[model samples]
Target: MTSGKIGNQASLQSIFDPIIAAPSDRPFVVAQLGQSLDGRIATASGDSRGINGAAALDHLHRLRSNVDAIVVGIGTIIADDPQLTVRRVDGPQPIRVIIDPKGRLPATARCLATGDSKCLVVTSKAEAVPKGAEGLVIKASAPRIEPGDIVEALFKRGLKKILVEGGGTTISHFINAGMIDRIHILVAPLILGSGIPGLSLIPVGSIDEAIWPKTSAHVLDGGDVLFDCDLRHQRRG
Candidate 1:
């Protein structure tokens, strides 16, 4: 069996040693994703069909089992219409959160009416608040529905840990905002040479470059890989 160390073999320190903050009032945020060998999370046209194997999907559900909440963007909700619940195992489903900046989430989405899970739609103060949804819709005032703002709102609601399963923009927004505490990236063995790149809008510049996304990775079953990185403060690149 191939065995690896978290720090020595994979630079887990470089990835997770920094501290954005210890467990605080705000929920800790983690960005979780799986990409192809070529680092693509979807197709060239933004399709994520069959990108992950059944084992990878099941592994993701396992990861989901440990969090207090799960977040995604409205675009992801519309495109995937995911139930965003814990299944395939006997574990409590985390709360479901959607960042709908323009208040665009449909009232008819399953998230709105699910009794098994609570749904929180993060929207801007200026945008019309979504109404008639069975789920608890908590509104927070912000100039814009930014990545940091979303976490603050969740924290206020007493969720201490959040998992982000994204559509790229949402993940990148948190990465850029320096709000992500850890990143759990799963890598599949296949390669999608030309697809929607897994990362979106990382800042470019000496100052922006100072924040680096360093990670230590391990290979999981079925040729899948896992990288856990701490983003709060790693040595500025």
Candidate 2:
């Protein structure tokens, strides 16, 4: 039973799909989500109760199986407190990553717990590094490690691909910093009316845009939409 918990038809294909289906040379995938037309990621109390569906959830774990790591910002860690493990399918376990600017993860956090996969905590502040997390820490000297620096560090560690899944701020930081190689935006059927926009900041533009990544969007089952795009040089018109 995949995370989607669907019938055997969809389940069968998902179960047998190759774990390493992604191209070896491709950079990591950064997936971001906003909400449906209503503009909400959760209900009034801030719970992601209906943020994802069965099929989408299953596909999410399947996608997780293809990457080398999964990332999120500290805000997500505090909010959802996810385990960040791939459980629905069988595959090589990917590393869990957290971008904690201030090293805010609690020692009691599930991410620091054993049973789940180990986590890589990236931060620039010295005090943020946890006591038992020396090996897991990737310290950057910059006041704030830019996206390029983060990717370069990951690459040096032999990680050719990674996946970033989180709230709007983290997504925007990567996009604006121009480190995201590819983006997958899953749009649910409902909306939040007033919550965080999918992106914290949208790049201002025309031919003079600082960054441009070629992007394409697609509609999926159950009113969900997916946008997969490559981020690279864009020649001005």
Candidate 3:
């Protein structure tokens, strides 16, 4: 077995190479989710703390440090209230973004607090921007904002490397919309039996209809398995 110390650094660099080398013409979007062995992100009550081990958590912070911006839905803000800062390791913090189409984000959300990183809220044209944060309004008749529009707007703003750090629904939308280039799934060695699932894409009639991205797995410290899935070529047409 490979030592976590030696393997972790090499694996992280390898995982980030594609993202760091992406072209500047468009946004290179990656989504990440931490789930149980049974694919549950949280319990039914939504308590999702400490699912993956310290090494996986450090890897997440590393990802945040390397990316230009980190995006999440309002649901994650409400449920987790994450700071979205790079604290586990010594590196620059990334810009924090939120997808709150209906203007549901609270004024005092932790992510909105001032820090080294700026915060951007993606909302519908009619929604009011939350105080203390910049806004990127997209035209949408429905309450939901399109994932593609969000990506395009960010790219236009010079945030070409984007990380969709999520609460499942947000990640699902980007993945289903074919806007994601890669996905990193960290699965812990425990099973919740029943809880919030990690991904919820559209239904498929047969096994052949399921997605099959080019994937590689690495074992993190504390027995968590990280699946690095390259979805750039496998996205739906």
Candidate 4:
């Protein structure tokens, strides 16, 4: 491998060491988001493509390869339609888990198609999995499923390392629920003056009340900055 590739691998290892060393009885959940310098994940019309550079994209695929499963909210499915595979690197593909509370996943969604990796749909008890999707269905309480419950269910199924690859809503749910152990926020150089914001959480009254996670910053090959925030102890009680 080239020196640059070696450097990237070393950086990834350092970033993932804590997650890989997490306790086995529960899931080690990490959430990731790629946004612009101004914190917009997409434009006003929901058009989010190429927000991060090639190096940051590789970093994401490396994350997918390490985790046992990857989870996303249905909004992501409808918008990005990502296959959620480990194509950029050589590692076992993680299971694709979708939080589809309303059963809105279309029949033709790429994630639902037959593939090397298995797909699991987590829905509300009131909803059913879309027809003809060859995967397991997990049901939780109505309106929405608790992030903790989702983590527990996945852990029971042997998915101990989980990555929440999302639209902002899904990551926020996990963070607000105190189920996330860490979060990786990759910030690109561009600025979107107006668009969909990257993350949304309960507001704090003052700057002192804001969460200041123990974070480490790394510059990716193409100038995107990756902030590895350690939230293991900063989670809400």
TM for every model, in the order presented, reads: 0.79, 0.76, 0.93, 0.91
Candidate 4, 113-201: lDDT as tens digits: 75588788887643467654434455554588888888988898999999999989999999999888899999999989999998899
Clashing pairs in 1: 15-230
lDDT of 1 at 56: 61
Of 1 and 3, the candidate ahead on lDDT is 3
> What C-alpha lDDT values do all the predictions have?
0.70, 0.64, 0.87, 0.84
**Which residues of candidate 2, in runs, are more than 4 Å off?**
1-26, 38-40, 43-45, 114-116, 125-127, 131-143, 205-221, 233-237
Candidate 3 lDDT over residue span 18-74, tens digit each: 988998887899889999999999999999998999989998999898889999999
Which ranges of candidate 4 are over 4 A from the true structure? 1-7, 125-127, 131-141, 235-237
TM-score preference between candidates 3 and 4, better one: 3
Instruction: Output the worst ten-in-a-row residue range by lDDT, candidate 3.
Output: 1-10
Cα distance off (Å), candidate 2, residue 132:
6.1
lDDT of 1 by residue, 30-149 (tens): 888888988898887778867776656765676566677898988888877778877765567888888776767876777666538777777654344455332333454654466766
- In what order do the candidates fall by lDDT, top score first? 3, 4, 1, 2
Q: List the residue pairs that clash in candidate 4.
A: none
- Better structure of 2 and 4 per lDDT: 4
Off by over 4 Å in 3: 1-6, 125-127, 235-237
Evaluate model 4: give its lDDT: 0.84
